[model samples]
Target: MSIKITKMIAKTHCYIGQNHPNYVIIHETDNWAKGANSRAHATAMKNGNLDGTVHYYVDSQECYQTLEHQDGAWAVGDGKGKYGITNKNSINIEICVNPESNYYVAVDRAAQLAAMLLNQYGWDTSHLKRHYDASRKHCPRRILDEGLWDNFVKCTKSYMKKGTNAGSVKPVKEEEPAKLYRVRKTWADSKSQIGAYAYLDNAKIACPAGYSVYDWTGKNVYTNTTAKTGTQATKLKGLTPADLIKKIGPLFTADQLKTGVLASVSMAQFILESGWGKSGLTQKANNAFGMKQNLSGNTWPGSKWDGKSVVSMRTGEQKKNGEHYTITANFRRYPCIEDSIGDHSAYLAGAKNGNALRYAGLKGCKDYKKAATIIKNGGYATDINYVNQLCRIIEQYKLTDYDVKAGNTGTDSKPAATTPTSTTTQKKTFKVKVTANDLRIRKGPGTDYAFTGKYTGKGRFTIVEEKGGWGRLKSGAGWICLTVNCVTRV
Candidate 1:
């Protein structure tokens, strides 16, 4: 017997194509009709005012036909085309029930109906989909959230695997596996340190000369629960610090304070390095970490407590290279959090020293590891362990949470701590091409002077004048081109 379907024709145009592959989309009526049949919807479709109809309907008891399989239907809208799917190549099936009914049966029957359709086209269960999948609508909301779709896929795959369709599943091509990379320590051989720990779970393994290892996800070499491996230790979503308020509370800006992790890291590291901001350098000079001094200038700005002598960096030459030891007197003590974060980022970024090396490839360094390494190897910090400690702190205390945007509000509008360029709003001017390259013009009507644009040798002005450069005089005004003008000593 041939399958029969009762369909509702909406006043909308049917969108279907013949060449496209057939896709079965299932939906729920979400009606309150008793016994799983929605008479109201059927009536609405017959009035010519109806919107659309599905190919078939399955209730708790029996199946009802709405439309013929071969006939075009208007259930799925044209918007599905946005997802590269067209209704012409698809079948829409609806299942009606009380929103509070046992939804599992609907999902099960939907899968069965889908299988029936799949058999017609010699297609596998993969061709079946949900209305939500067709477009971004939240229709059949309950079925999707209950994981019915995943369950349906599993059942379909299982049934297909047992039959002639077993070999029909897309074949998995065998290829070379990806190469495993090992992380290396920048100064693993240095004499100033005790050996670092190897894999947390694999006590039997030791780090090789150039490689350092960590297993945050416990992918391998982990047996004991005590080991800090896998996503557990590295996942810094939720961590509680004992001395959060006491150590780093006062130092955090409004933005930093908003992020719990960044705030915690700042507190923990500061306490570990400066002893609660009470260390000799911190108490007297406000140098929280006893960061080495390197400069000649005497005036920067700092409160003198106990006469401990403060140092500030001089703005003579930017981008210092290589490693220089001892305090050269160039360290500055920032009075606020805004300056500290900016300076810290710049100092490690090399961009801080006006050296582009640190900023070269650091933009997408999401995790702290890459950012720290780039800073360390890029020669931003003299300390070899700088990157490691920074990365570790960021990991340990989840410092990213406390990441505050570097800026200020209200009375304390000190220019940001990083480069002065960041605070300055430079005018954006597009290059306007002139008829001639390197063309020069006069600054005044008396042939006094001047120059616009790029200097490619032959002739052109490095600067362009708007009005007074060449006013009214004679012989086409006093505007003398740079090529025609003679240089006069000012």
Candidate 2:
């Protein structure tokens, strides 16, 4: 069966970022209807009606490539990835099992398609896995239920032995792994660091008193579970969902008191984006609210960070058609959950889409529903069900109690923290695209002030407060030379 390449016209649900297609996952489309076939399924995905998407659909008559192998599929997430098989490092192929189709012939065609992928990776039948292997769901149900899995593997090996489709597919280069599991107390306070490890288990073992294991992104992944007690010292992976709330809830409340962004809405975002604080980004960067290290080098005012403390990772973004793609950007690294909450609130309170605040009405919004709607309308997220999801989370968690009457009521009102009773001349703010990586940051405006020992990284940064010849960083790290050769006002 020749493969008909029918790529998704727009980005689809098939986004998990770039991966090395080392293993091929076999699945059987459980649809037993007569007309269901490779082309039909591919068209369904292209039209955005499929329940989830896989890379290829194989039938007896034809093999249709629905999604790219480089991007991940939404195929095998049921098991929470306990078996080392993840959507990020595998390829997915679904064999059609419509009642009128020849299921056996379709299985054979799937075997050939698997052979082509294996050839690309220089792999063999052992690397071929089932949806059952990753998620333990009864996928490829017919094959498992009827004792056909063994025969399918044997058929794939036979095709491999014959070298029948060696050069049909291109070789895939492996993505570079994340930098390292650098264990530290906090990314900002690196002097308290002890050791770094390549493996997470080893890092956990080496973590000592008042210290934690951090990934390349500066997330607090592991702490010495035996040495201390409660939320902060507990082993991270072992914490239940309720325990995660215990860890992050207080941080959001503290930030709300200072900025008046709804704690309920922000906490709801934290719940959804970080999978209730169990996602790797939360584990790696401590940004549970899905605060992306955005493409623009934005370090919002009131954020206690320099541009250097960021996790370079892949995050999913979408087009207007709801098609998704992955891009690598910097997510800010937080020393603590409080820092993440503070930075997120600052972003919501100050980030601008031209002259207007992106989530302008979020601050002091007493109504959770209105706050969530404002977030959705501001293009803060692309999910169609974003507002609904946030509302559900808020009500389910009794999160509205966290809201304080600090000013906003869903109108064009400022938070109590910023509601100026008297008018003062606002300083002009602008962006400076720093061309040099070593621009000296100072304690005061002039060159006479002591050095703060921070460098402005090469990126566009917001200059909020200015002195005679220096610009204070919006991040509150320090001030940089405004008239330097490297600093160009954008």
Candidate 3:
């Protein structure tokens, strides 16, 4: 499939392109207004109606190139600051998702065009970035809001590998698959007994002097003393209702706490869903909120464990007729309590979930009772009395105190507190030379960020700001992780 690039008439005074474009910035038109598409955007650019310019406009049908690859477009709002990728070093591509157009189809074509550009420029997926990365204006709002960024990247990578030939490869040794074996309780209580040994011999050795060994699937392998597996299994760490509140009270992010989600509601939901973190799935998997394994085609990102290894436990579902029945379903497993809390916050926010517009009213609401009602009405829980139960939990334990501490003043009159900033001070600008192989300068501080360009051996850049060991390159070239010793100060 070839991407048709329609060029527009050059405006004499428009942006000048860079000779070597190093970054690809993705954006959405967000103009759901009538007749919005590649052609309309191209017309706007041609007619001088648009102030900012982009290199390409991708709709469901075709891609329009309004500016040459050598010219820079003012697509990212960052402008030509010290970080000048917006108009100096990056090619901007906008996807058309008007009210009438199919956004999914537009995004699909956009990804294809992005892959083609990457291949043409000899760039990798690391160079692909959203407008949000350049400046957190939420430009590609729907895409990031719906958690489809990963899916888009996956699509790009898939297209990148399409025609590459594998040719001949040397035979490689394969390692044994990891194994999980269980030890009976008599050998040691399940809590003390190491769960899931990597080897059967290790499990046998760990079975104490007399207990039997069983596979993780609970199949009996051997028996020593009494041949009877002890019936008692050690309980996982159990927290009292008060302890649960204290444990999770301070864990909420400032953004989440400010989003109008009541801390009392959050804590109550955790208690109700996790059963004070004592439920089988909660104990085994640390999934405190009982979130489902996946949403549509999207699973929770950055799961430490194999997401497929889920804990299926019985849950109560209430029908419209007020009848309750137990059913077994797989739930997501988190690596730690923090992950669970973070996911819970994202779920309530809904924007990070696939349903970006759903439960929007729950965010930033001051009334805990109203927040619970909104959650219930938004289909968050099946129980009819879910709101009442949440309210009861909040009242029973005075969880409102935590909400108050979270900066919810009970009245919606005052603006929420500003997001807390890191205490680390940025060091003064200094020059540095690239010391590592092909060090990438990213749009942000973390590896999760998109690369603006790569600096090979001996390449130098001026670091404008430093935070968390990441140096922001001068002239908006992007950021480099200085902690890895990739660049040495000169």
Candidate 4:
């Protein structure tokens, strides 16, 4: 079918050209129903609705176009301009899948199209992104939840790189369906349980003991085995956790990898709070740690989880004289997992919490658990057992292994406070004329800050410190930095 183009599509500028590094971003129409296509076309160019358009749409068998290949589509925002590509550099590729649909034919088509785009642009599979990558909205929820996304990307990248292997693309195996299994909890297998579960299919069909027969959604998706097996792990060969590790682990930093610190907090915290970075918070918000703070009027805009439901202050009671913290339903979000971890570290660095103990240089403390307790008892959280839970998670998963191996291992430990330098011995300071029309007095002992009214260069102040052509002056707001010629102390 010929794809219809809106008038807005015609007027849109082609921001990106062949010269730009091309990227294909995947999205979902997010609207279900057979007539969704017609609705999309009619509403696309509506005056009130933003004049946005994607390159292609795949729905089961057909492809629709709201804009031509050359037109710029305002799809993703972040990482776009920063990467030297504008909105025009991205192609909005959408899949039309009804949320209620049983089979995801559109997903399959999207994967193929994504592969085609990668090959056509000579871009790697890493260029592929979900719509949510750029914004805080869920576009392709169905396919992502099904766990087919990883496989789809893997297949697409492989196909684009060397063309598909004839046997590799065979219709998904049916007769000898792979069975799903649940891990029976044991101390020995608990450390890497998530990894073990994720890679079960690739572990050679043998049951990992106590993991009874399950289908792809496992007991959660189906009522019984009599029904069709969902995404049988046993069907695909060459499936392994290493594949997932390669896809996910490398995206993290050395500090994150070695310290079991996924984002911030211990990796176990991410596993518990974000389900191993599978929760919408980590996937969408990049917020792996559920740290909450009300900024301006906006709450951290993403998703949240603290393993089970987090117990927060629900209501604040106005006692006749004071307010009491009451339990509430609130959680924190981050822009990305990286942001979440960075915020987590920043919080520990800033807040007086038990996490501070985890710092290796913390005087007297040796590890996270001990540090956690110290922080907890020192009133990190109001919760009586907050430290215990954090300690439990750390010990349960041996998360300290990662933190201990981090390059900044000893850095977190508290440093010896420096004794204030005596300003007794000093040199005669000279003053210089300000030649520039609009000169600035830096804040530190350098020429880096914009001068406030406090330093006018006319006032004679003592040169308390000097370094790199800048001098420190004692102003009303403590010591401030000024250029060498700005002031002098005789």
Candidate 5:
């Protein structure tokens, strides 16, 4: 069956039609608000609200063509810079998803669209690419997170062979859920690194030192298990040197604390770099550790920035000749120490700095020494003694003792207890359609409340309550204003 294309009106400047597309660049809408689907995205494109233009939006039911394939869309941010070839000669397709949409269906439709476009242009699966391959902003996050990008390409290839009626072209089957395995450096080590895989051979290949595999129900499956798998018998059984634990200990998130990045190593790095938070950057700008400005030149949507706030300082750089010299460089300024800590984590996690490929093996590394070694080898610092210095600080402070075993709780470990509070107020339920772009949903009924989320373009939502012209969403995310002419009752 031929894919239905709903053409959207667009500004003449939105795209250039002379350049024929040679590749298909894939992206995700990234909007998590309810009902933000292909039609909604089409509306946003027609209204001239989208920051950039894409050729098509593929949803579960239909594909909306916002720009012609012969034209160059501004989806990739290179803008005549690096990867400009794709931007000048590629078709961009955005797969839409939201709380109300079926993401798998959308992805399947996107695969079909990609295959059709490839066939039409006489191209191949080699022409497929994620938005990240062009500019590295981590677009199509769901596909990447689930390790489905390769499968997507394979499905597209299958579709190309089978023609438009390629619904039977199945993606690669997902691997069976593997037993969770924990590995530690020593029995005395308080924390262990966790990984999941199906086969014992794969688990053994991961270097089985102080390792134990657990079943789906969190029961140890290893015949001769020595590794601890459950909650600690005693809380804070081993304590780090109280004097060595810096004031920044509480800044780490629970997930970060358990991320196999030894708290001791991170703390020592912070103390050594920031001089116990007494540096000029720390005192003036709350930048406890020196992190350079993002050199990628890509603006991620949710990242924090004031645009004008920055600090320049001289730092040591090691040359290929093994000589160190001081050079001035600009560093990021943070509003709080928390942001600095988060940025540091992101730096090591390869979220910033555009060097994710360099530090690919650092995540969930239980051994602090190995982590240090990886960081050093990943070119995190020019200092040849970086790993040694970090290890020395960790050993001196006994920081590994402070590391706690991660709980066996699933994805959302901290489940909140649901207790009904006293409430006699009545609420009427009604359906409403969002009529505005970028509508903010606040925690309360007023603008003064903190924004919980946002809706891009137009969408439909169920209002369960109304107070002073503010409507509370049935999803319980937050409240939106009904008084603002941006929403109408359905």
Candidate 6:
């Protein structure tokens, strides 16, 4: 809690002369260079001739004040006037994300520093803004990628309340009902579910195109029809995988709209976890996602199951040491597939691990890959290839099409890569700094070309060739923007 603040104020020429700060801006140094910590940045600021600068540089161990709080730094000049947060009005805090430093620790330290600044200025979280907020450039890539901005704000608020950063924050608990019923086409196909009801008759009455009603433990209690009346489209190569995507598209889309969960990513989980709705657990318990009732239970008020109904089944699990074992565990069973899907969405939006949502920022994530990564990093699964598996499923099925259309919403629907009218041709191999968080890799050298589904991260990469202001990645990934704000010669 007692973060050491080391002062290394910059020369007058390095930063603007004066600043009456009204807000605090958060940023991240996209430098993975070795030893690029708080002190390193401070050292750079102390000397003259710096192209850009910030008020403070924070790492895991300490915070470095690079400039007096009154002086304006070069950061966020491009983002001026958006929040009325110009360089003159904002004090920038750059969190070091170098390879050698601890990212989570750095984030905490930054949050603490922000809290301290808020204390100094007597301002609230409304005073905080990501550098991206102003410039539209992805500065704190990880925070946006993993959806940590809200948690960061909450963490800062907690620090402000506690007055001391000694203990962690915890989410408040809520209440739940005793039982729930699910409505679905089939017990095995969880994605085909339509609704979850607190009462059995209501669930039965709400069942659509499927005369099936199951209990929380996945036991089929009632069935009025023996056949599926809904039409089924021809499958690709006779595969059942994601074949039900069309049937359950609305369910996931609704979830995305209401909860900010990426429909594509959650649909991919339905494929992997339920084995395309053909898994034994799905068939019997209607638990498509291997929904185990963990110790935390359902933190969401909407999903706070009474914890009375569960199906015991043998499940395979892996260890960090590449070890695998099977054990009988109690998995939360859905009365219908809809309940499972709804409950899954509720869990993501509401479940927390001591003040942080289990899948923080997943509720409204637009990028499927980022959502998948958040799920994987949030410890949703043990499969080392979990993210890749989910992403493959999403891209392969074009599940993103089901995501809510907010005009170029999903990652698959990336914003147009505008070509530069002025072209630059360079033959020699060189490195360029990739600042775009979602710089698409095109199969050809222009926006008209098809996307390779690959993207450039915030870092440096080798460009083997250049044409029309685009650089061809030496790794054969694809061509990316070489002249746009995203890419610049390192």
Best by TM-score: 6
lDDT of each: 0.40, 0.66, 0.61, 0.42, 0.60, 0.67
What tens-digit string does per-residue lDDT give for candidate 1 at 1-490?
1122333434333433332447888788766544446344555554544466666665432344555555556766745677655566678777666543334444544555566567667887668777766675544544542223444555444434433211122211224221111122323323211112211311212232223433323233322233322111111112223233323443443423322223333433454344334333343234544344432112122222223323432111113342222211334444433344333433332333332344455533444565556545655445434555555445544444434433533235221332111111222221222232222333342222322111222322222232211222132222432111121111
Off by over 4 Å in 2: 1-236, 295-299, 405-490
Give the Cα error of residue 374 in candidate 6, in Å.
31
lDDT string for model 3 (1-490, tens) is 3455667854633556453588888999867776797889998887888887888897765567888878778777564344445666788889897665556657766776787888887889999987766764555755753445655776666656552211132211124222345666543355334333424544554354345677645677865463322111112244333444455555543325445566668877876665555545565557767777764344433333445645544444667665544344567756566666666666666533354545668777768898998888767877666777677656755666555443444454222332213314476899876644445567876444654544434567788887544678787878776533234466
TM-score of model number 6: 0.43
Number of clashes recorded per candidate: 37, 4, 15, 21, 0, 6
lDDT of 4 by residue, 318-413 (tens): 232322232222445332344455455444433432333333333333465655655445443444434555654445333443343334444552
lDDT of 4: 0.42
Per-residue lDDT tens digits of candidate 5, residues 329-446? 5677676666666566665665434634465677677688998887778767766666766775566545554443366333543223222121122388988876445466789754
Q: What does the lDDT read for residue 446 in candidate 5?
A: 47
lDDT of predicted model 3: 0.61
All candidates in order of lDDT, best leading? 6, 2, 3, 5, 4, 1
* Top lDDT prediction, candidate number: 6
**What C-alpha lDDT, on a 0 to 100 scale, does residue 58 get in candidate 3?**
79
Better candidate by lDDT, 3 or 5:
3
Per-residue lDDT of 278-381 in model 2, one digit per residue for the tens? 44566555666667656223445787545566654444455666444434445766666666777788888888787778888788787889988998888887
Write model 6 residue lDDT over 56-129, tens digit each, in one string.
Answer: 89876667788887788888888667757788888999989877665765786687778878877788889988
Better of 1 and 2 by lDDT: 2
